[model samples]
Target: MSTPSPNTEQMTSQPAILDQTIGSRLKETVGQHPDRLAVKSTTLRLTYRELDEQSDALAAALQALGIQAGDRVACSLGTSIAHLLVIYACFKSGAILTSLNPSYTSQQVVSALRHVDVRCYIASSDILLPYKAPVSSSTLLKSVFAACDQDDGQVSVSSVIVVSNGAPNEQAIQDSRVWAFEGLLEAHRGRVVEPATKLHQDDTISLQFTSGTTSLPKAVALDHWSILNNANVVSHLWETTCEDVFVCTVPLYHTTGITALVLAAMLHGACLSMPCEAFNAQQMLRAVVEDRCTILHGVPTMFQAFVRLRYSPEFAAHDFSHIRTGFIGAAPIVSSLREKLNQQLNLSGIGNAYGMTETCPAVAVSTRKDPDEQKFYSVGRPIPHATVRIAARDDPHQTLNVGERGEVLVAGMLMKEYWGDPERTAAAITTTVSDDGIKTRWMHTGDEGVLDMQGFLTVTGRIKDIIIRGGENIYPPEVENVLMQCPGIESVAVVGIDDEAYGEVVGAFIVLTIGTVISLIEDTKSDCIDLRQTTGLQTANDASGSVVLTAAKAREWVRTRLSHHLVPKYIFLVDELPTTPTGKIEKHKLRTQGCAALAITGAIASER
Candidate 1:
C-alpha cells in the first residue's frame, strides 16, 4: 500500500496581526509620547525622546563602523541605561542583537562569541576588564591594539565598544578598533542615519541563548513579529498600561526580562525601572517603593529573596504598597510559597508564565484576574494567538485527553529557528495533520504537563526529570509540592538517582529555614561519627545520621501526601540548593551530587 498524502490545510490563524517591528513600534511610541519616561536605571534615566535619539546616534556610529543588516552585535553588559540604549541601537541599525549574561566567565563568553559570529562586542568597563587578558590577542582586540596578532582560525569580532563611567582602561584607550561608549556617542552627535537595509516584521531581531542546563546553550533566533506580538499578549495579561511602572528584577539577557518586562513595557508605553546592575533584593524592594512601581517581574528565587528580606528590620521601614501585581516563573512555585509571596510582597495579584526561549518565551500565562486556584496552581490558558495541546510522550501524533499527563505542544509565535542548527531545530519542531485536515507545526516543549477542561495547564515536570522506580513513574514536582508543606523546609528539589535494583529512585536535596536546627544522633555502627562531629557535621556531613533521620521524617511526610513509590528514599541537607544563573534548581547537578552522597552513606543499599 502507498502512504496517504498529508493534509495541506493550515492551522487556525491569529485574529490580529502585527505588521511593524519592535523598532517601528518604538518609533511610533516616541512620536506619540516623546516626553514619557522610558527607562530609569540606578545611574541614569531616559525619556522616550532621549532614548530614541540616543539609540539613533549609537546606531549611526555602528553603521559608520561598517555594521550592516543581519550582522550580529553581542552585548555582555548588565542591566543599565546603556544596555537598553545599545539594544535599541542594534534594532534601529537592522543588526541582530545577541545578549550574553554579564555573569558569564571569560571562557564562556568567548565560546558564545565564536558560536554566534558576533560582528561588534559591547560591554561595560567592569565586564570587559576580565576578558582583556584572555581575548587580548583575538581579532576584536587586534583591531584596537595592533601589537596583538589575530588567529585566522578563530571567528573574529570586528569592533569592541566599552561603556565606561570612571577611569578608562589604558589598554582600551590605545586600541584602534576599540572605542569608549561615550566617545562613540559623541562622535556621532547629531548625525542620525536610517538603517541601510529595510527591515521587515519577519526579519530576525535577536538571538538569545538558552540556560543550557542539559547541554550546550542553543541560540534561539526570534523575529521582530514573534517578540513584539508575544510582548503584546504578556503586557495585556499583566494589565500593564501607559500609567504603570514596571520594576525589572531579572537580567536583560533572559526572555523573562527582555520580552516580558522590557518589550512589554514599551509596547504599552509603561515605564521600566532597573533596580541595580543585577538582582539585589534590597535594591529591588527600594525601587518598588521609591518609584511607586505598579508591576514587578522576577523568577521564584528572586521573590523568595524578597520574602526573606521582608522579615529584616531594614525592610520594615520600606513601604511596598505600590506593588499591585507581579510575575513569578522559571521554576516550580508551590502553593504555600505563592500565598506567602502575595502577602509579603503586598501584591494584589501574581501571575505565573510558562514558555521557553524557543517560543519568544511565553505561550501560557496566568492573568491577575484568574481564580486563586488557577493562578496559584496552574500556568493558565494559552495566550491569545497561540495554541497548546498535550500529546503522548513517545508519539507526537497521538493527542492526549484533557486530564492526561503528556508532553506540551505549542504552536504560534514560535522561533524562526535555532540559529545555525537545523538538525536540532527539526528535532524539536514537528508537523502533525489532524483527522479534519488541519496541519500545524508544533514546538515540542519537552516538558510534561496536563491541560484541564478549562484549558489551564499544570506542568508536572520535565520528561527527563520523571523518576521511574520499579515500573512506577514519579513526578518530582508532585513530591516537591508535598514536601514544601513540611515545617522548617525553606526550599526542596526532588531528583532521581541511580539504583542497582530499581534502575532509579527518588532523592531530595533540601534547604532549611534560617535558624532552624536538626539535632544529630550518632549511629553506633559508624566510627566516623566522632570525627564528623569535630569537623562541624552540620555544615560538612549533610548526609550524616542526623540528615538520615530527617530524611526518614521527610519520607514519612511524603508518604501521607503522595504514593508510596513517590516518597524520596534518600535526602541530603544542604545550606543552599544548586541553581542556574536564572535561579532554576539545577537538577542534574543535584542528581550527580546526590548519587555520590548516597554511595558514600550506603543509602542505596538500605533502599534495596
Candidate 2:
C-alpha cells in the first residue's frame, strides 16, 4: 500500500450569504442599470430594461397559460438572445428552469423531459423538426404533435413553445398545444408577473442534469439560495461589473456556461456577448476585438482550439488585448496551453473555477490576486460560504490532515437534492457532527483531492478513477500530469486495463501535437504488441490524427518520473481523445475502446 499523504479540515473563508431570488437579482440589476446592455448577440443587442420588460412579458404569458410557480419549464433552444429571455422568464414566473442541450435527438430530448417531469417545453425548430417530420425525411419516425403532442403522453408536457431561429414568427407547429415565442410575448407585452415571494429561498428553482461522464445523467435540483449565491460568489471572484462583457463560448444549458458565466453576468449586470449560436474560434476572437469582451470562458479543448486559431491569417489582425482574463473549467488546463493563452492572447489574469453541478458549482475558484504558485497549481481556496474538508476515503468520519489525499467533502450552498431520487440523494449526502457539536450536511463529492497547509485545494482525481495495480493505488492524473511534460504529447488520459496477474495495469491514450513526426511504440516482448505503427510517423492534416510520440521514448520518459508501478504498461496513439458533450475526457470510454482495439489487433489483452 502507498504511504498516505496528509490533508486538512481548514474551512474556506465564510462571507455573509446573500438572500435573493433569480428574479430579484434581475430586478435589482434593472433598477441599477436599465439602459446598460444585457446581452450582445450577432443579430440583436438587448438593454437591461428591454430584457426585463421582455422577460416579464414572457413570464406573464406563461402564467396566463396556467404555468404556475414550481412548474418545470424546459428549453432546448440553442444559444441566442431569445434563449436568454426564456431563462429570465422562467426565473420571473417562479417555474423550475432546465436548459437542455439543443443538439439532443427526439428520443434523447423526450427522455430528458420525462426525467424532469417537464410541464412546458421551449425548443428550436431545428430539434423539433426531426421528431415532427417522417423518418424518411428526418432522423426519427415519431409523435404529441411530434413531442408536445400531449395526447401521445410520452412526457407530461402541456405546451410546446416554438422559437424560430432567425426565421419569421409563425406557427412552426400546427397543433393547438403549440405557440410561437414571439407571438406569446407580443400578446403579453407591457405585462409583468408578481414577485417570486410565493417561492421560498430553499425551494427548487432549476434542474441541472449531470453530464454522465461515468454513468447516466441525474437531474440535480438546485434552489434559489444556492444557485443565486453561487453565482454571486463567482461573479465577485471574477470581479465582474456592469461595464464588463462576458463571452459565452460554452452552452448556457450547462452549469459552466450558465452559473459561471451567464448567471454571473446577470447577477453583476455585465453584458453577455454571444459571438455565435455555436462556438467558432474566429467569431469568438472577433468578439473580443469588436465587442471588447472583457471576460472569456472555455474548456481545455476550446482553449486548445483557440491556440491553433489564434495565429491564423484571418485572426492575426484581431486584438485579444481587450480580454482581461478567462475561465478554464470541465477539465485540467495544460500548463503549456495556459501559458499560451496568457502570453499570446494577453489574458494575464486567468482564473480557474472548480465545482460539480451538485455543489451549486463554485466550491473553489483561483483568482488574479493569488500568487502564481498557488493559483496555477491549485484551483484557488474554496469560494466564500463553501466549507471544504478532506475525509478519509474509507471513513467519512475521519478527517485527513493537510496534504493527505481523500474524498473531498463540501458543505454550504449545495443542491437541494437529486430530483426525485431520494435514495441516491441520501447516499450522496451525509449528516456529520463536528467536534464542536455543530451539525453540517456534507455532500460526499466523489472527487478525490488534498488541501495544503495554506488551504489551497489540488484535486487529484476521482476515487473510482484510482487504479489498483498489484494492490497499489495509482492516480491517473499523477501520471497524466507528468506525461503532459513529455515531448510532442499534446493531451493524454490514463486508464486501468484489466490484468490477470496484477489485477490491473496503467494504460494511456495519447494525442500528439500536429506536425509532430516521431513513433515510440516498438513491436517487442517487453513493449507494445505489434503496434504496426512505424517510426517517423507524422500527421500534417489535423491535431486529432497526429502520431508523433512513440512508446520506446515515452517509456524512457515515464521510467524516471513516476513510481515503477505507475508507469503505463500500454500506450495507444489516437488522433483525438474522446470527450463528453461538456468537453470532459471520457476515461470510461477510453478503457473500453482501448481493450476493444487490442482485441481487434489480435494482441494478448494483457501482455505488453
Candidate 3:
C-alpha cells in the first residue's frame, strides 16, 4: 500500500492557523531588516537578506529535484549556520525536515530512515561511504548527498550543502544519485519565485522520536499550531523580549533546547548563543560573560557542573551579574543544587519545565519571579492558550475534582495525530460531551497530577511509575526527591523490585559525588553524625542495634520515619545512573534489570 499525501487544503479550515508559518514570517522579517544578522556561529554569520535569499534558492533547487510538499527530507548534519538554512528551506518549501542523531549506529540510522520513509538525505561524505545495511531488510531510500564543510573544520556527514573545498570521499560520493550542495543551489538561482501557500494549522511540522520506558522509541508528530502556540505561550509566560540574548548550552536535538531556546528565540527576535559542542562549564561561563547574555537555558546536570566550577578561583572571578534568568529543565533539581545556583549566578529565575515531546516540548514553565517552591516543587501552571485537567482513569469523559490526583488531560494546542498510526492516535485522544450536547476531544497525557484552587498544576507521577507496596501507594519521584537530599548523594533513582513477602520492594540507586563515600564514612566514624544524618533522615536506624547503618540500614531508617511500605528495601550505590538519549533515566531498563534478579510481575509485563 502507498502512503497518502498530506492534504494542504484542510489546514485553512482550522481556526488556530496563525497569520503566517515560520518561513513566511521570516521572509517578511528579512525584507524589512535585510542587513540585520539572522543567525551566527563561531565561524560564520548570515544577515537576514542572505539567509532568506539562500533559503529561497535552496527551495527552488529542491523543487527542481522533484521534491514536493509532504515529502520527508532526512538530515544528519551537526550544528552549523548552513544546517539552519537547510531547515528554513525545507519549511519554506512545505516539506517536513527530520534530523537524525549523528551518533546513532548504522542499524539505528537504517531503522530510522525506514520508519520515516525518507526521500532525499543530506549528510557528510563519510556517513554515506561504505554504506552497508545496518539491518537485514529492504529499504527504499532514494537520493543521498554529502553537505559542504564549514569554516570550523567540523565535518557534517549529512548536510545537503558543503561549503568547503576538501577532497570528497571516493567510495561514498560515487553514487550517481549524489550531488554537491553548492551546485544544487546554483542550479535553481534563476527559477521563478514560489508563492507562499496557506499552511494548515494541523499540518505536521516535525517528527521527534522519544524512547518510552518499556517499548522502543515512538515518533511524535507535532503540528504547526501546537509548536507555534507552545513557543508563543512559553515566550509570554517568561516575558521574553526582543532585546534578550539567550545562551543555549543544551543540544538542539532535545525538545527543550529546540523549542524553548532556538525556536522561541527566533519567534521573539532574541539573539541566541549556541556553542558548537556540548555544555562545558568553563566554555558556557565564558559565553555567558562575553556574549552579555541575559537568559540561560540548560538541564539540571549542566547547572550542577557549573556550580561545581564556582569552587574554582578562576571561575569565581568571572562576573555573572548580567544574567537575569537561568532556566533549568530536562531533569529534577534538588534543593541544594538550586540554592547553589541562585547564590553563585545571582539568577533571577531558577526554573523547571515539565512536558513530553508530544506536548510541543513544554506544557508548563516557571517564571523569573515565581516563588522558589513553585519553581522547584511544581512545574508551574499551564501556559496561556493551554488547558490541563485531571480525569478519571476508566472514564475518560469524567473530570475529577480539584486537588484530586488523576490522569492528566491536555487540550488546546495539542498535536493533530501520530503520523501513520491511527490506532495510537485514537487511543491517545478520547471524545467527550461538553455542556449542551456539544462534543469535544481531549489528549490523554497518561500522567497523574492535580490542580490547586488557584489553578496551579502539580504533577505527582506517571500512572505507570506508581509503586504499590502492599496496600499503600508510593510515588518514586517523591521518594527520590527526599533521597537526593542526602549530603553525599549526587543523584538517585527509585524503582520497584519484587519480593515474596511484599508484592514489590522499592530499590534506591544512588550516585555519590567524588570522595563522598570516604567523607561519609569518616564523618560516621568520628561520631560527628549518625547513619540517619548521612541519608537525610530525622530518625535513627533500629536494625539489629547497628549505630552506623549501611545502605540497607538506611532503608530501614527511612521506613521508621515514614511508612514501612514507603521505604526502599534495597539500595545500590553506583557511579552514575543510566540515561536515555534525551537525558531521562532509563527506568524501564533499570526495572528490567531488577526484575531479572527477582521476579516482579509488573516489571516483566509486556508493554506496547
Best by lDDT: 1
In model 2, the runs with Cα more than 4 Å from the true position are 1-15, 127-154, 166-173, 195-197, 211-214, 317-319, 434-437, 517-521, 524-548, 603-608
Residue 345 lDDT (model 1): 66
What C-alpha lDDT do the candidate models reach, one value each?
Answer: 0.77, 0.76, 0.63
lDDT digits (tens) for residues 1-608 of candidate 3 = 42232121211112233545777667666666677656666766677677778888888877776677777776655445556666777777877776665455555665665577666566543322111222211121222222122343222223233332234533333445566777887877645447356566566667766654435656677766677667766766666766777776765555565677766766666676654533456767677777888878777766766777776876677768777774676655665567777878776475677677777777666777777766667776666666677788888777787767889887766666666778887988887777899766688877888776656677777777777787667888777766666655677788877667877778777676654542233123211222222444322332233233356445544665566677776665555677654456777666766565443333444341
Q: Summarize candidate 1's per-residue lDDT along 155-226 as a digit string, tens digits.
A: 567788887744544554455667778998988878775887789999998999884444778899998898
Count of backbone collisions in candidate 1: 4
**Model 1 vs truth, CA RMSD:** 5.6
User: Cα RMSD to native, each candidate?
Assistant: 5.6, 4.7, 10.0
Error of 3 at 109 (Å): 2.3
lDDT of 2 by residue, 1-608 (tens): 53344222233343457787788778888999999898988778999999999999999988888898888998876568888888888877789898777656667777788887788888765442111331121232134346655566657778878776644434343667778888999999999788445766777888888854446768989888887888887777777888898877877787667787778888878898887766666777677778887888778887877778878887787657777765777776756566777777776677776788889887887776777766556777787778788899889888787778889999987888888889988988989876999989998888888887677889877787789998988988778877878888878889998887998899988877665655432534333432324433433333465454567778778889867888888887777788766678888888897777667655553553
| True-vs-predicted CA distance for residue 571, candidate 1, Å | 1.2
The local distance difference test score of model 3 is: 0.63
**Per-residue lDDT for 36 in model 2?**
89
Superposed model 3: Cα runs more than 4 Å off = 1-17, 31-33, 124-173, 182-198, 277-282, 518-564, 597-608
The ten-residue window of minimal lDDT in model 1 covers 525-534
